[model samples]
Every structure is written in structure tokens, then in C-alpha cells.
Target: MRTAVTAMKIPPSLLSWRSDSWRSDGRTDSFSNEYFKRRNQLKRLLFACLVRWFMTAVLVMGTYLVLWRYSRKAAMISNKKKEFNTLIIALSIALGLNIASSLKHLDLANFEPLQRPKADYILQSENFSCLFQLGYVTRRHWVRVYVLFWVLVNVASQIAVASLGLTYNINSADTIAVTTPGVVAIPDMSNIQTGKVLSSNSQAISALRYTANNYGLVALAYGFGDIDEMPKAGSLFNSDGDLMYCDLNSCYYVFYEATPDNLDYYQSVATNRSISTQATCQSWRVLKGGDGTERTITIDNANKTQLTIPALNGGSQTTFMVDPDRGSGPTWGHVLAFEASATDPWFYNCNVTIGPVTNVQNPLQDVGVNVTSLAASAIALQGYGASTIGVSFNSTRHFQFQSYPAESYYGGPQGGNNTGMGQLMASFAVGVVAITAQVNTNVNATGLLPLKGIELDITSWTYVHIILILTVGLQLLLAVIAAVIASKVTIRDHSCVGLAAALQPLLWKLDNSGSSRTTCEKRIFERLGDGVKVSYIKGRSGLYYIKADE
Candidate 1:
């Protein structure tokens, strides 16, 4: 018997099926292939697919093996985001192509018949409800578990690959050996000229300086690169005794710590505790004649200049030897003495030191060394072409009182008349840190070496390889299984319209008088079984039709 089917009027959405996708080896009734002959053809197709599966496996495995070996060191990349993204994109494209090739297979054994239920799992792999269709067929056809396995593995590998960067250590960043100018003071600093700290147009340093315009004139010069608008480094009178330096986003800190040392001289006065809190303690006082009862006026033996604060009741005694010549020639160098009365516990004599800090755990805490005299240089510039920045501090320039004024010790620097000794010390420190930060900003450094970085954490970062393995591995394996039993695998557009059109051959055979809706079509076919022998033929109007025999 011979049956012919013309094109059906299908909606645009449902007509998307590629009806001609399958190759019809049998012609019309005159050339119809017997059932056993077609079955043999399916068996040969199965063998060919098995060969393809093995080739796919070898291709995927060998490609990844070469990749894994070549990336043993994986030389650190400076632009991590760019390079890593490139790698992921390349893999995604390659995987996509490989997956596309493996998708349209009727993975089957040589003798198995293509059944309605089996085709459901095979052909519907590209459907929107593919997961659901796969689930339904999985009861009798468990090969879909392999598909689900690959899906789950891909999800897991993707998550691991996304977070892989966080696991990397400093080795992931590219590095180069470099010999740079070390920290110096005076000639040591001058010899290693850091790039000039700022452009001539910038008043950032002068503005943040504790000294007025005249005093900071020496430090204001066009030396650092010519960036016009730059971030200001330290605040004016930043008396926290800590400075922050930044380069290339990495940061460092300098903290000034005051620790009490062995007393050079201590004289007990008959003045009461109230004497320690006198107005002279408000600002660093140019000490005049003391109370004259127990206080004696005397010059420092070394420089003859002195800053004195006679303790008032309930306050503290603070005195520092002043260097008159503004030159480094005194026996004592630069030291401050604060002697709280026997009853007062608030203030004590201490020496100053600067500590190196990579992290800032606490801003209030003071942290590193005894300051006999500070004349060292801090390098702000990084790499070649960096301008040499130098800071030279000599004279005792006055500073805005930051803390501990006798008038209101609890208040922050209120009613202070004398200059803070540490304020002067802060001037030196501020210049060091600010200059460094400024020069670093111009050069775009993270602070020290620009290339400082970490290596890949192999334990976690290797997830990229696993992504390839699971994506390619199970895909090939399952593609082979999904290809099982069916004679032909459709490679054209897998649209519902195309599929419905191709069913024209079965149109006249199945029962659809009352329950002929699309939903009942599957049951109708299950009841009838896949026994029809059909062929696709090109018609004269550039269209194709279906022919079936009974």
C-alpha cells in the first residue's frame, strides 16, 4: 500500500521544524526497503557512532592533557582579569563547538529498535523542557543520568572556577627583580634622589604641612611627575603620630611611639601639683623666669636655648632642650622631658620612635624606636624614571598643638599657647610619608615594587581543568548513549513545526477522531507502535512531502 501526505497548514511558531532533516534511504513504495534492511542500516549507523564517540573521547582527553602539561607553571600574568577571562572564553567556545557536534546522535546498540519512548529522550534533548522530558524517560532509559551527571558537574566546576582567584597567593602576580633606592636621610637620601614628590603647580604638600607657606617653601618644587591634580597625603597638624603611604593600591604606615627612658636630670621643686598644669604647659613655652621660689632659670649647656613648662597643681611638667643653631651639633641631639609630679600619673618622660606598619589594626595605638635625631630619607618613587624626593628637617618649627594642653587636657588642643615638641617631630615625619605617597601616586605604584603578587593556588585553581573534563567528558559519553538504537540523527532545526510536518506520513494511520489533539498524539503512537515505513521526497514546487506504505 502507498500513502502520500502534502504540507499541512501549521502556525508560524509550530512550523519551525526541519522536516527534511532526516535522510530517507528508502524511496516511494516502488523502492521501499524492507524492515530488516532498514534495521541493518541502523546497526551500521550505530557502529559508526561508536567510532565517533571514541574519536571524540580521544580528542577531548588529548587536548586537555596537552593543556594541563603546558600550564604547569602558568607564568603569572599582570593583567589577571583580562588573561583569565580570555582563557575562560576560549574554553567556552571550544566546549560549545564540541557539544554541538556531539548533540545530534541517536546513541544506540547495533540491534536496538527506535521506539517512541526512546526517541522522546534522544530527539527532545534540545527542547525547552529537555530536563523534564529527560526525567520522564529516565525511568526506563537511565542513560540520561549521564546527562544529568554532566550538568551537575558543570554547575559544580563553574562555581569552583569562579572563586578560584580568591585562593591564589602572591605568586599569581607577575614579578621582576629590581634594585631601588633605599630609605635615606641627608646624603643617603640625596644620593638616591626619588622622583620629585610633586608638580610645581601643586600646593598639596605646602597645604598639609604643619609650617606656614614660608617654612615649607624648601619642600615645594616641581620634581615629582607633572600630574596636576593629585590626592593630598597628610592632614595639617596630623598629630596621631601615624602616617599612611600608598602606591599601586598597596599601603604602608608609620607610627611614632613615645616611651619613657632613663632620666638625664630630674630636680624636685617645692611647687604644688597645680604648678604642673600652668598656662606655660598649654603651648611649648619659651620658658622665662620660673616661679622663682623653687624653680631656677638655666640655659641648656649644649645650645643654651630651652623650652620650659613648670608644672601646676594637678598637671604635668614638660620641658625640652632647644637647639639654637638649627644645625646638628648638640650633645643631646633632640629630646623632650615631661616630669609629672609625684601625685600626677597622667604624664611621664618618654623618647620617640617610628615603626613600620604594613597593616593598620588600630589607629590609636603607637608602635617602633628611640628618636635621638631623625635625618633619614623615605623613597616615595618606584622603578626607573621616578624622580628623587628628599626631605631635610633642621630647625624647630612651631606646630599646632594636637593634644595634652594644660588648659583643657580632656579637650582636643583647646587654649594651647605653647608649641608641641612632637609637633616639630611630626613635621619631619609628615614630610617623609607625604612625599613618598605623593611620588607614588604620580607613578601609580602600590607603595614599593609594582609587580609584587601571588601565585595560583593549585589546589583550588585546577577547577578550570575539571570544568573542561566534565563538560567534554560526560557530554561525549552521554551523546554516545543518547544516540543508541535510532537509525538517523536529525541535525537541522529541531522545531516542533518541522517535527509535526514530518508526521504527515503517520497522519492517515493513527486514530484521532475524538482525541486527536497534540497532547494525545504521543499516546496514540505508543498504542500503534513505530511500525510505519516512510520516505521523504522532493516535490516539483521546491517543497518536500512524506510517503508511507502499509
Candidate 2:
């Protein structure tokens, strides 16, 4: 047995300990300097295993916080997933730095240190699989096992972090409703008479003519099947923003009130916006030339009729109209034409149903007010009181309406180079609220705006935010616990040079035993069969070393 041990070249450092403890070799001065340099092992390990891990966790969680908010516009990466991926990669690298610190952390894995496999300790530091092997190998000891488990926990959190992309993929919401930092336009009737918008030379008249061509009116169908179910959709961009919509139900109308932005203050802050709505809606459809005579079609003023694309060109036209019921103040009237031609009829007489909307704070519910002559004269206004009556709103809501904005009139993506209120509200409705290079020839029309909605009612969203919060939150919790439990004591360096230095006494006593002089360490370890058992020693002045006994 002794001869075989000798042939195996087992170092004296592993076989037995010196009686003096301090070797009588010529390396005392070198050993003393090395031991003194490694004194703050505990502090270093604390920072490595705890401070670093927590910092990484915070960074990861912070990234998720940004992603949860759809309103957060990123200046750097436009794509959501690309931005998240970049952040994950950068923070993960920061997390990886802790691995080096953990190599020496095993020395202080527990308060009362005991003998373990030295080769296993050193091997597990750099190799991932080796760490698991050490974990299983040290399963009998609670502290070491948990320490290993802590590292695994960190790894698990990172995996969870990696799965964030997948989570977004699987759980992304199709549509999101939020009150955003912007504006929606509803007409202010008070300005109409004072502004002389009806005058032939008025800016509104010119804008109206341009609107005829730029946003040509299309006919829509209003199902009489359920007028009682007034459209909950609140936007006019797709359908009329008027109270007169659907089969024929009376309405309690409220609208977002905003003035025409001069394109300078295009993005209106929703929090500061004033809300107003009309009590009822009255729609008028006027047809000219198709049936050989000018005919004014009046549908149920209490309900909206769905329209189809009006027949075009063939010398005929169908127009949708808006008659802002003249209140005590001067509210204007609107004529939206299906075809833009100088000869096409304009209604000075009241026979057509005007797609009218007004501002009312409170409107009596389930009551119908049919104002066919919304803007006839002050004499008519005196007969009924203000065209739009004011009421107190106990509870009002901003409902949703699904509408696509009028397409580029010029017919190309390289649209106008100025954001009209018309297209500005349209862009963000798709996400990425922006008013980019939108332009038009008519300066009056370009400056005027259509109603743009700000996010107020968030009924749904693009991604499942609650799930993401819970998952990332859970990841943070796990990471924090692991960091606390892994308060390691690092005695030796994790680098190959530091590891070699720690085992110097043993290495120095061994010689190449294989016939091949250039044999690798792998061959030598294989010949040794089971690896060496190791124990630690506290020498003079808190110096530490790995030693073994036969």
C-alpha cells in the first residue's frame, strides 16, 4: 500500500502535516506576503455575492418598469423587443461578474468550516456543470448546499429574465386604451358667429371646401335594429362624433372640447383638457341629382343610420351634415360633401339631417330631443332656450370609437411636411403618437384639426402587464433571498494563478510520473483515481491555506 502510494506521487502536503505547522522551507517570506494580501476575504465575498447580485436584479426590474408603460416613448430603439433585449444583455453581463467572486466564496460558505473536496471547489468555480456536481457532492451539508443553491437561484432568475421576451410574445394584448398626453378636438360653438365662419371669404368656408376634397365624406350604415344600444364608441374619426347615430336611440352625449391647435401646440395634455358633450344628436342626409331632384333625407334624429360609400362622379352627390345647435352663444353649422365640385349643392335651407354634436355637461338620459333646425335663427333659439343646454355631470365617461383617419390626400407616404390636427390625432391612435411630415396646399385646412382623443379609458392593452409585474417581481424576490443567504467568505483567488498559489505546497512536491514528459493535468488526475480530500488551516496572523491528512 505504501509503495503504490509513493508511485502515485501523492504530495506530502496531502499525506501528512508538518509538526511545526509553519514549513521550514525557504519560502516563509513569500508565504507571509501572500497571506497578508488575502486578509479581507469576507468583505470581498460579501460585495461579490450580495451587492453585485442585488444591483443586477434592480437593473433587470427597472428595465421591465419602462416596458410596461405604452406611453413611454423610447428615443433610442424603436422596436419594443429589441430595446428589452439590449437591456437584458447588458445587465446580464453585470450579473456574470459575480461568478468570479463566488469561486472563493465557498471558503466562507458556512461559519464552522469543514473538510471538502479541494479539486471540486476549484473546478466548480469556472465550469457550470462542475458547480452542479459540487452541489450534489456537498448535499449532506446544509450551508454549502444552499450556497450552491443560491447560485442556481441566481441562474434561475436570469432564465426567467430571458423568458421575458417569450412572455411578451405569448401575452401581448392586441389593443390598449390609456389616457395619453395629447388632445382630441370638438367644436366650440361660441366662436362660430363671432368668427363669421359662415361668410363666403371666411377661413372656415375655405377649410370646409378643402375638407370636401381632402376628407371626402363616405356613407355609413346605421342599423335601426338597435338604436337603443347607442354606440359606446366615442370617437368621430371612424364614424360621426354626433349624438345621431345607430338604429334610432336617444343619446346623452359628452365630447372632449379642444380648440384648433395652430400646429405649434399640437400635443395637448389630456389632464388639462376640458370635457363637454351634447344632450342629443340629429343627422341629415341630403341627396342631389341622383333622383332627378334635390332631396333632403331625414333619418330618425334620435338614432344614427349606417352609411355606405356614396355613388361618385356620375353628376350626383350625397352629403353628411353637422348643424351645431345655436345656443345662447353662436355655434356654427357644417356641410360635409360627398363629392368636391364647385357646382355641388350647399344647404342654406334646413331639410337635410345634420350630423350634429354639441357640448353638454349633463344630459337627461333615455330622453330624445329632435332639433331638426339646429341652427335656424336667434328667434328659434329664443323659443327653446340655448341651442345646447348646460347640465351638471354627476357621472360621465369617455367611451371608445373605432375609426381610421382619412388617408393621405396626395396619395403617398411622403405626405405633407406639417402635422394638421386632422392627421396628428390619427397617427398616435395607431401607437407612437406622433405628427410627422403632414402637409396640404390649403393653409386653412392644414391649420384646422379633427377631434383627437387622449387616453382616458384604458379598457385593454397590448401586453398582459399584471403577469409581467408578478413575474419580474417574483424574480427580484428570489434574487434578494439568494443574495442574503450567499454571504460567502472568500479566502483565495478564483483565477488559475491564485488557485495554483493556494495549492503551492502540494504542487511543489509532485513530479511527472507518466512516461510522456509533457503529460497534461487531465492524465495525472485520472491516475490518482479519487481526488484529494482537503481541510483548511488558520496560520499565523489570520493566514489561511488548504491542507489534507492521510
Q: Write the per-residue lDDT of candidate 1 for residues 240-314, one digit (tens) a residue.
A: 322333222122333221111232321111100000000112222223333222333333234435433332322
Q: In each prediction, how many residue pairs overlap at the backbone (N, C-alpha, C within less than 3 A)?
A: 51, 40
Best by lDDT: 1
Per-residue lDDT of candidate 2, residues 169-272 (tens digit): 31222122222223344332221121222234233422322222222211112111223433333222222223222221111222222234454433211111
| Residue 384, candidate 2: alpha-carbon lDDT | 15
- List lDDT for all candidates, in order: 0.34, 0.32
RMSD of 1: 19.2
State the TM-score for model 2: 0.39
**What CA RMSD would you report for each candidate?**
19.2, 18.2
Query: Which parts of model 2 are misplaced by more than 4 Å?
Result: 1-40, 47-58, 61-65, 68-118, 121-123, 135-151, 163-490, 512-519, 526-532, 539-543
| Candidate 2 accuracy as lDDT | 0.32
